[model samples]
Target: MLIGDVARRSGVSARMLRHYDTLGLVRPTGRTVGGYREYSAEDVRRIFHVESLRSLGLSLKQIGRALEDPAFTPSALVSDLIRQTEKRLAREKELLERLHAIDASTPTDWQEVLRIVELVRELDSPSAARRQQAVLARPEDVPVPAVLLAGAILTEPDTHVAGALRWALARSGGDGVATLRAGAHAEDAGIRRRAVLAIAEMPEAPGALEVLTHALGDLDTTVRRHAALALGRQGVAAAVPCLVSMVVEGCNDVDAAEVLGMLSLDPGCADRITTALVDELASPTADSATRIRLAQALVELAGATGQEVLRQLAHDDDGDVALVATALVGVLKERSLEDQADGHS
Candidate 1:
């Protein structure tokens, strides 16, 4: 077959076939009297083989080796190609995300586009300071898109930078709530933790309550505690059990106690919160320290139930718990007297 006929039948351009010959990738097996390149049946088959290998992302050099080297094994090379393809896909995905973030920002001009691009680069910078500065130093005029901030908070390992990113996201007027909601359900505990922390700071953000509520059931203890505290502050009674557990476990128990106190202001929650505290104190496994923590938490509750629980705790078996409960009862009595005096005045 002539090279032209092979090109026509095989879809390999003649120009490319000549280049393949120059590279010794596929040389025509015959020549006519005019000295034009000619291809035999075997040569045309080799051309198809070269095109087939190229389709799998093989480099020309690799393809040459694959075709010529008897010892060349394709398994390793194919694995390497897979790795390379995966890396390329990752880079493309990152670029696409960056573009989406920029478009979401709705930049008004080239300068704003450049600024958004620079901010995104800074957010992904290796240096923690640079990532933090990317969020903190973002010019007031060039608002960093909420999606960018949401993405950063989900992956930021630095505590300070994460806090700053959450602050920026909260101020984005809840635009990133959906991203955060997705993060809240991520299989990665760290991502879920970051998502809940960010959402906690944005209590007023749309869907923040729902995401936090969902996070309350997370398997991660830290994620659940943060969600519980945030929910408690939002006046969601669903947090009461976790908040009480926080007190019982001595995990940020003081803050949990404070939130419980605030929750007691709602008349509906007062008895339930008091009962949870009293139950923990009454548990057979309750040690002196655990009982003492529960005793202190009771002081934060409103209505007489908490005081009655405290009064009963004042005579508890554990001397330390009894002392603490007695002190709290005195404090509650003082508070009640103060309330009475103010009313009379």
Candidate 2:
């Protein structure tokens, strides 16, 4: 419904909605492309709940929590809202009963309210850090362009506050996301970490491969880890050789296995990867348990090719790799016989 329609139907004014926004009372489900508030049926239901409590003189905070969560059927959430509303309503009722006496006994204290309004002027009103200081300078005054600045953060990454999106390549989102394909070489560790996560979260683009390729040789282990993971998820054959190196070079077990699984699934490219992993299974690092675990992950890639890898794995110096390799080889023999029987069908 339109804000005007909601105002007529629910008896909540348009101005109150802005106040509610500051108090975190309610929010529109969405805004129209033309920039108008849009509410869904579920939003209307939450609004009605807020309206009922407010009519009983409940504070905005009391209604805000209940309106935010829907799984609030249990006591801890709903009962608390009801209790706050009842307590505030009782205080308001007493004020109504003593209205005449209170008015006669006390002069209105505009001084305290004005003092509070003056004190608030020193604290920042949130915008980008550049604008927050300006807003706080005059709290009673409307912060010029604060609303426009907020909308820019969503539409333009450059306008973002000090969070994930701000570091995005200037104003373009994917440009920043694509920045981390090359691992941290000269870049600061924190900057490279932030850039790597940003790019990995975004969908791959044609230019992203070069970045991913460059990252494979990065001096930093973690930046290389994220780059390997992204290449594996992208599942392009161009990444197989690099992923193999990552498995061979990486210290982190889970990431190596993830790259191996994705490498195996890269259609028609499976044979080369399986053959290499089989060769590595026996002679992988003597000092590390990660090698054996990586070999088992290779076995998953091997399937029938598992026999070759298992032979190497059985001879592995690591006791756990030898045991797991022997057991998997036995399982493969049974499966092979079953396949032979099914072939006659």
Which candidate leads the pack in lDDT? 1
Compute the lDDT of residue 10 as modeled in candidate 1.
Answer: 97
Off by over 4 Å in 2: 1-186, 245-250, 282-285, 288-290, 315-318, 330-345
For candidate 2, the 10 contiguous residues with the lowest summed lDDT are 143-152
RMSD (Å) of each candidate, 1 decimal: 1.5, 25.6
Candidate 2 structure quality by residue, lDDT tens digits, 1-345:
767777778778888865765666777878888888877777677788888877755567756655666764446645666788789898896445334322322324755334333323322234445433333343333222221222222332232332423322232322333224332343666556545544555535445566665666667767666677777777756556556656666455556666677667654667877766655544635334546555656755734564676777777667787887788777777977998999988
Q: What lDDT does each candidate get?
A: 0.90, 0.56
TM-score of 1: 0.96
Residue-pair clash count for candidate 2 = 2
lDDT of model number 2: 0.56
Clashing pairs in 1: none
Per-residue error at 283 for model 1, in Å? Answer: 1.5
